[model samples]
Structure formats: structure tokens, C-alpha cells
Target: MAKILVAFDTRDEGFEKLGSEHEIIRPPKGRDFTLEELQGLLPEAEVLCSVFDRPARAELLEHGTRLRLIANFGVGFNNIDIDYARSHGITVTNTPQAVIIPTAELTLALMLDCARRVSELDRLVRRHPGESTAIGRSGYLGVHLSGKTLGLIGYGRIASAVASRARAFGMKVLYHKRTPLSPEEETRQGISYAPLEELLRLSDFISIHTPYSPETHHFIGAQQFALMKPSTIFINTARGSVVDEDALISALQSHTIAYAGLDVFEDKDIPRLPLCQLENVCMTPHTGTQTADARRAMNEEMLENVARFLAGRSDLDRVV
Candidate 1:
């Protein structure tokens, strides 16, 4: 049996399925394993159950003398050094199927929160209970969603799910990806493919779903923001590094974009000063798939990857 090192503290239900055959090392409660803590355990670990918060850099990957598989707990594997792992003959996998719906739901939630100013108004009522300023029709006006153009930055599973939800709300969906879909496929899904520039300029609501990589780092910056409408509502459920936060702040401060709803940020924790202080923006603590159902699904998928890899199966969810 292999030594499985769990770098994050997920619930024990899924891991319990491994029985007493394999040894599992877990971090302390309420925290992820630090790099230093992980390094000490790497030599004996044949598998690593990784989370997105911690960086699985080259130094850590190199220390895994017995490492065979790195099963990431989330869909996006940006936090792990995939190239280095492959170079060292180690396999890397992620729980892609598990996060699709929950992340799409979070994206929709953020979109509605920004468009309706839900969180801001809720906070207003709570901070000053029974205040008249919080009331009246003209006091806190917000945008309506029906018949608005929604642009998706990536045409992945999560983005496809978002498109379905957007269509239900009478939103016109446009998507921009590395490769445009054929006209027949577009017609079937009711989503039109547009060039990046056109999508940026025309979309009233823009949702980013692209993965983070060297080619996509700060993919949306000052120039891209400049192309957007002044009344645009921006939503990002993807990695924070995909957009330049400094440029995003500049746009928000100058009203270059009307509002932003963000689930991720460049900083690992709470965002920088001006973003936190912005009244026109709404933020979540990167809890895109924090629901109990999604967590359980991710754990199951991760375990399946570990099981398949150990059994010498090639049909598993192998990303790298």
C-alpha cells in the first residue's frame, strides 16, 4: 500500500474508504500544511492530496522521493507545478467534474449580487437597523438582468453551465475561447462566438472562467478593461492572477467599469486596500465549491484518481 499525504484537511468520509491498507498523513485541524511541514513528509509519500491555497512548487515536488500521484482537490491546478511534476515522472490530476455546478452557481450568485447590489444593501440594513436612508425606491438603484448580454471568457464545462442559467434569465450569451465553436454547435447551445475585443466591448456582464497559466497571466488588464462598456458588471470566478488587480482597481475607481463581483483575488487571503473599501464591488472568500455536496464530490473524485492511478489504469482523469 502507498503512503498518501493529505496536505489539506477535508472531511474524513471519503478517505475512510481506503481502509487500513494505505497509510494517510493529514495536517492539523483548520489549516493546510505549510511548505516546510510538507517537505518533511515528502520522502515517504507516494501520493499527495493537494489543495489550491498552498503552492506545490518545484522545491516541494523535488523532495517527493516516492511520489507517484498528486491528486488536487479542486478543478483548477494552477497552484501545483504541473510541468515539474511531469518532468519528474509524477502524475497530476484534479477534481474537474466535481466543481462545475457549484462554481457555476457561485458565479451566478456573484452576478446577481453585483447587478442587484444585494450584499451591499443587506449590509447597509444590518449596520444601521431601521435607518430611512436604507429605504425608498431611488435610494439604492441597481441593474436589471433580463435581456442583457453575458460574455463568457472560457468555453469550459463551468462556463457552459453558466450559459444555461443565463439563458433562463433571458440573457444573450456570448463566449470567447482559444478555439471558436462551429456555427452548428453555437446554434444548438444558443451561444455565439465572438472575438475577444468584440465580446469585451459588447458584453454588459463579463464572466471570466479561463485557467491560469503563463500564456493567460493577467489576460485581462488595462487594455481589456478599456474596451469594456462603462456600465459593465464584471464577474470572475477563476484564478485572481488572470486579471491584473491593480488595473481592475483603476477601472473601478474611475468608473471604467460600473461594478465587479469577485470570488478570487491575487492575494491568497483578503484583497488589498482599495478593493476592500470599494462600495461598488462584491467579494466572496474563494468559496466557489464550499458547499457540502461539492466538497464530498471533490473528495470522491480525488480518491477515485488515487485509486485508478495506483491500480495502473490509464483511463483515469489524468491532466498531466
Candidate 2:
């Protein structure tokens, strides 16, 4: 049997679906692996599988002589040191298409919640007991999403899905992407291309679906925040580093933007940020890809990448 080191443990259900042929080395609860420990167990490990764990770099890959592919359980491979792995001929893999719908749905849900202040009101009704705001208050109250301009920072599969849902709510969608979509995609999706500044200025709601990279780091910063309307709501379902959290916190604190909804934060730990200090920004843990259907899909896809690579087929999750 080819020994495989599972850096982090996935649920038993996911493993069972992975089949029983390979010998898998599972990590313990909350136990982080040192280079020595990883080398000790599965010394001849051929493939490594994980969800969020990052393996030791440089010497670790050199030490892992038999390592061929790294099948990551999640879509983002940021946790792993990809550059070093690739240099040593180790193919890096990740589940990409599986979590699209789940993430898109969560993005829409967060947008609506921010527009309507749904979660706060729910908390008020539960905790306040007797005193409550008027249920039908208008004006500065809950804003209607219909007939509003929606801006997408990155026009990708998830953004297209969000646009579809927004269209159902009568939203006019605007997008800013490095490469614009085709004419059929524009017509079918009911979206218009705009420069980043123009889209930011015109949009009543700004949503980020961009991937995290050097070019995308701080895609939304002080300058970008200054361009948005005070009535606008900002939503980020992408990576945390894609946005500068300090700028977001300052914008919301100063009421430069009316409200913000974030499913992912620049920091993985949300409570540590000043986001909770404001009542306007609705925050959630990085749960955009956490739906049951999406989890199942990601698990299956991740395993398939491992299987495909082991079967001497093209590496499906090859990022490097």
C-alpha cells in the first residue's frame, strides 16, 4: 500500500468515500505537525491530503522524497507553500468548481441581510423582550435591493451566479474585471462592464468575488473606500487579504459607507477586528463555502484529484 499523510483529519464520511485501498496517516485533534513528526510517520508517503493545514516548506519537501502530489481539500491553496513544492516537482491540487454555488448563495444572503439588517433585528427581538423598533419603518430603515446598482469587483463564475440572483431581485449589475465577458455572457447575464472607479461610484452595493494574489491584495483600500457613496453597502465573500481591513473598519466607523457585510475577514479571527464595534457591518466567519452540499462536493472533488493523480492521469488540481 502507498502510504499517504493526511495533514489534517477530514470527517469519516469523506475518508470512507475516498475508498479503503490506500494507507492513510491521520493527524490528531488540534495537534500541529513539526517537520520531524511528519517525517517520522509515513516516511515513504506519496501523497498528502488536507483541508486547511500547511505543511513545512523547503527541507520538508526535500525530506518527503516520495511525495508526488498535494491534494488540498479546499479550493484555496494559500495555506500551503506552493512555490517550494512546485520547484521539487510536487503537483499542488485543490477543489475549485465544487464550492461555487455554496459561496455564491452565502454572498447573496449576506447582501440581503446587510441591506435589511436581518440578523441584528433577529437578535433584538430575541434579547430586547418588550421594546422593539417599528416593524414597518421607512426611510433610513431597511433598504430595498430592487432597482439598485450592484457592482462586482471580480467577474468570475461565482460573480455570475450572484448576478443571476440579483437580477431576480431587479438589480442592475455592473462589473469590473481584467478581461471582460463575451457579448452573449453580457446579454444573458444582464451585466454591463465598467471601470473600477466608475463602477464603485455608481454602485449602491459593492461585492468582491476576486481571488487573492499580489495584484489583488488591498483591491479595496483607503482610496477605493473614499470613492464609494455613503449610502452604499460593501460585501466581500472573497479572501480577507483581498481587502484591507483597516480601511474597511475606518470607513464604517466614519460612516463613509452606510453598511458592510463580510463572510471572510483579513484576519481569520473576526472578534479580534474592530468590525464588531460598529452596528452597520454584518460579519460571519469564512463560511461562504460551508454548505452541506458544497462540503460534499469539495470532498468528492478533492479525493478525485488524488485518485486521478495516483492513476497516472493528468493532475486535475494542478495549480503550479
Candidate 3:
């Protein structure tokens, strides 16, 4: 049996299938493996199961002399040094399928939260209990989802799921991607393909779902934000670096966009202080896949990749 090293501590029940077949090594409950501890354990590890937030740089990977595969727990694997791992003959895989539904659900939740001012209204109630006249009914009004246009930056699986849900809410969905879908496919999906500039100008709500990469870094910035309507609501559940945070902040401050709901940030899990202080923005701590169901699904997918690799299967979601 191959040695599998899990970099983070999680529910033991999630690993029952893998644990029964391999020599599994993990940190104590409630904590991740320290750098020093990982260094000592890596030399014997054949597979390194890593999380999305943690850095799996060459400095750490160099210690894994026996490492053959890296099964990332999240859909986005930007935290790992992909080039180094590729050169070192280490295959990388990610749990892309597992994150789709949960992330799409969170995207809809954020949209509703922003459109109806759910979180803002809840906060006001908590601060002024029984004070019905704390603010007039027109003081903090919210917009409606029906009859609104939602522009999606990417037309991947998650974006398609978001579009499906948005349509159910009576919102028109427009998507932009490297390639547009066929006319028949678009009709079936109930989405329209639009050029990026036109979508930004016409959309009432814009949601980013693109992956993070050098080419997509700051894909939305000053010029892009300037194209948005003054009453637009922005939502980003994808990687934070895809949209320039400084540009986004300026837009919110100047009302270039009416409001924003974000789940990810450029600083990884820690959002910037200025962003946190904004009243017009609704933020979650990158909780797209925070549900227990999502966790169990991701664990299963990661373990499947590890199992496929160990069994010499060619279709193991190999990235390298």
C-alpha cells in the first residue's frame, strides 16, 4: 500500500475508504501539519493531499522526495506551484466536480443577499431591537432579482449552474467566455452570448466566475468598472485577483456600481480592511464550499484521484 499524507486535519469519517486501503498520515485533530512536521513526513509520502488555501510551493514540495501526486481539495489549484510540480514529475489533480453545486448555491445566495439587503437589514434589526422606526422604510431599500440582467464573466460549469438558477428567478442571463456556445445550445440553456463590453454596460448584476491565472489577473479593473452602469450590483464568487480590489473599492466608494457581494479576496482568505468597512458590500469568507455536503464530496473526489493514480489509471484528473 502507498503512503498518503493529508496536509490538513479534517473529519476522520471522510477518509474511511482511503484509510482502509493505504497508510494514511495526518496531523492531530483540529490542526494542520506544521511545515517542520510536513518536511519530516514528506520524504516517505507517495501522495500529498492538500487544501486550497495552503501554499504548496517548491520549498515544501522539495521535501516530498517520494511524492507522485498532489490531490488538491478545491477546484482552484492556484496555491500550488504547478510549474515546479510539473518539472519534478509530480501530477496534480483538483476537485472541480465537487465544488460546482455548492459554489453555485452560494452564488445565488449572495445574489439574493445583495438584491434584498438581507444581511444589512438583519444587522439593523440586531442593533436596534424593537425600534421599528430606527430608519424609515425607504431608508435602506433593496432591488429585486426579477426582470434584472445577470452578466457572467465565464461560461464554465459553475457559471452555467448559476445561469440556470438565475433564470429560475426570472433574470436574464448573458455570458462571456473564450468561446461562445452554439445557437442550439444557447437556446437550450436559456442564455445569450454577449461581447464582454456590451454585457458590462447592459447588465444590472455582474458576477465573476473565471479561474485565476496570469492572463486573467486583474481581468476586471478601472476601465472595466468604468463601463458598468451606476446602478449595477457586482458579485464575485471566483478568485479575488481576477478583479482588481483597488479598482473595485474605488467603484464602490464613488457609486460607480451600486453594491457588491464577494466571497473571495485578493489577499486569499483575509479580506482587506477597507473592504470590510464598506456598508454597500456584502462579504463572505470564501465560503462557497463550506457546507458539510460539499466537504464530504470534495474528500471523496480527492481520494478518487489518489486511488486512480495508485492503480495506474490514465484518467485520474491529471493536471501535470
Candidate 4:
């Protein structure tokens, strides 16, 4: 039986299938395994299961002398060193199928919250109960989602899901990707393929859903932000490095963009002080796929990858 090393302190229910077939080593109940602890346990493990937050770098991978597979719990595998794993002949896999709906749901939620200033008003209510300022007044007016245009930076599964929901709210959706879909496909989905520059210039709301990589590092910077309308609301549920945070902050400060709704941040999930102080920016602690059902589904998908690898199967969600 293959020995599996799980790097996080996750709940035990979904792991039973793996536990019955293999040896599963995990951290204690409430915390993740420390780097040192993981290194010590890696030598004997054949598969390493990692989470999105933890960095599975070469320093940690070097200790896994017997490692063959890295089953990542999230869709974005940027936390792991893909080049190192590929060079060392270690297969890397991610749970892309499990994250689609929950992430898309959170993206829509952020869009709605930013458009209506939900979080900001909620904070106002909590700070001063029964206050007139908390109520919707001329000074506290918000925009409607209807009769607006949403520009999606990446037109993948999650973005497609967001497009469907946006249509229900009477919003027009435009998407930018490496390859544009056929005219028929675009018509069927009620989305139009636009060049990035046009999307940025014409959109009322902008959302990013691209995976992070060296090629996409700081994909949206000062130049990109300058193209956006001043009334635009920006949303990012993808990696923080995809947008230059410094540029984003500058844009917000100057009202280049009216507001921003972000789930991920550039500095290792911690929002910088200047960003936190901005009243126009809404932030979440990267909780796109935080629901219990999503977590369980991710675990099951991760385990399935491990199981497929051990069974000599060729069709797995192989990343590298």
C-alpha cells in the first residue's frame, strides 16, 4: 500500500476511503503540519497531499525522496513549484472540478456586495445602530447591476458560471481569453468575445478569474487600470499576483476605479495596511471555496487522483 502524507489538519470523514487502502499520515486536529514536521515525515511517503495556502517548494519537496505524486487540494497550483516537480519526474494534480461552483458563487457574491455597498453599509449599521447614515440616503447611494456590462478577464469554467448568473441579473457579459470562442458558442452563452483593451475600456464591472503563472504575473497593472472607466467596480477571486496591488491601490486612491471586491491579496493572503484602510475596497480572506461541502468535495477529488495514480491509470487530472 502507498503511504500518503497529508500536509493539513483536515476533518477525518472523507479520508476513510484512503485510510482503508493506504497509510495516511496527517497533522493533529486544529493545525497544519509545520515545515519541519512535514520534512521529517516525507522520506517514507509515496504521495503528498497539500493545500492551497501552504507552499510546497523545492526545499520541502527535496525531503520527499520517495514522493511520486503531489495531489493538490485546490484548483490553482501556483503554491507548488511546478518546474521542480516536472524536473524531478513527480506528477502534480489539482482538484479543478470541485472548485468551480463555490468559487463562481463567491465571485457573484462579491460583485453584488460591491455594486450595492453591502459590506460597507453593514459595518456602518454595526458601528452605530439605528443611525440615519446607515440608511440609504443621497450620500449613500449605490448602483444597480441591471443595465451594466461585466468584463471577465479569463473565460474558463468559473467565468462561464459567473456569466450565466450575470445574465439572470440583466447584465451583459464580455470575456477575454487566449482563444476566443466560436461565434455560435458565444451566442449560445450570451457573451461576446472582446479584446482585453476593449473589455477594460467598456466594462462597468471587471472580474479576474485567470490562473496565476509566470506569464500572467501582474497581468493587470497601472496601464490596465488606466483603461477602465472611473465608475467600474473591480473583483478578483483569483490569485493576488495576477494584479499589481500597488497599482490597484493607487487607482483606488485616485478614484480611477470606483470600488474593488477582492478575495485574494498579494502579500500572502494578508491585505496591506493601505488596502485595508480604503473604504471603497471590500476584502475577504480568500474564502472563495470555504464552504464545508466544497472542502469535502476537494478532499474527495484529491484522494481520487492519488488512487488513480496508484492504480496505474493514465487518465488523471495530471498537471505536470
* lDDT (Cα, tens digit) per residue for candidate 1, span 1-320: 98999998887767766767899899888988888889999989999999876789898988898899999988878789988998889999998899999999999999999999998888887888666654676877888789899999999999999999999999999999999999999999999999999999999999999998899899999999999999999999998989999999999999999999999898774588999899999999898998999999999989888888877889777889
- Residue-level lDDT of model 4, residues 1-320, one tens digit each, is 99999999776656755657789898888999999999999999999999988999999999989999999999988889999999999999999888989999999899899899998888887888666653534766789999999999999999999999999999999999999999999999999999999999999999998988799999999999999999999999999999999999999999999999999998897888988899898999999999998998998898888888888997888899
- Assess candidate 1 and give its lDDT: 0.91
Segments in model 1 whose C-alpha atoms lie over 4 Å from true places: 16-20, 27-37
How accurate locally is residue 292 in candidate 2, as Cα lDDT from 0 to 100? 74
- Backbone clashes for every candidate come to 0, 0, 0, 0
Q: Residue by residue across 27-94, what tens digits does model 2's lDDT show?
A: 77666555577767645899877565464556566667788888888888877778888788888889
Q: TM-scores, in order shown?
A: 0.91, 0.90, 0.95, 0.94
In candidate 4, how many Å is residue 104 off?
A: 0.9
- Best-fitting candidate, measured by TM-score? 3
Off by over 4 Å in 2: 13-21, 27-36, 53-56, 130-136, 268-273
**Candidate 1: which pairs clash?**
none
What tens-digit string does per-residue lDDT give for candidate 3 at 1-320?
A: 99999999866555656656789998988999998889899999999999987889999999999999999988888789999999999999998888999999999999899888888888878888777746676878888899999999998999999999999999999999999999999999999999999999999999998888899999999999999999899999998999999999999999999899999999865778888888888999999999999998998888888888888988876677
Q: Least accurate stretch of 10 residues (summed lDDT) in model 4?
A: 131-140
State the lDDT at 77 in candidate 1: 82
Error of 3 at 149 (Å): 0.8
TM-score of 1: 0.91
Supply the TM-score for candidate 3.
Answer: 0.95
**Model 2 TM-score, all chains together:** 0.90
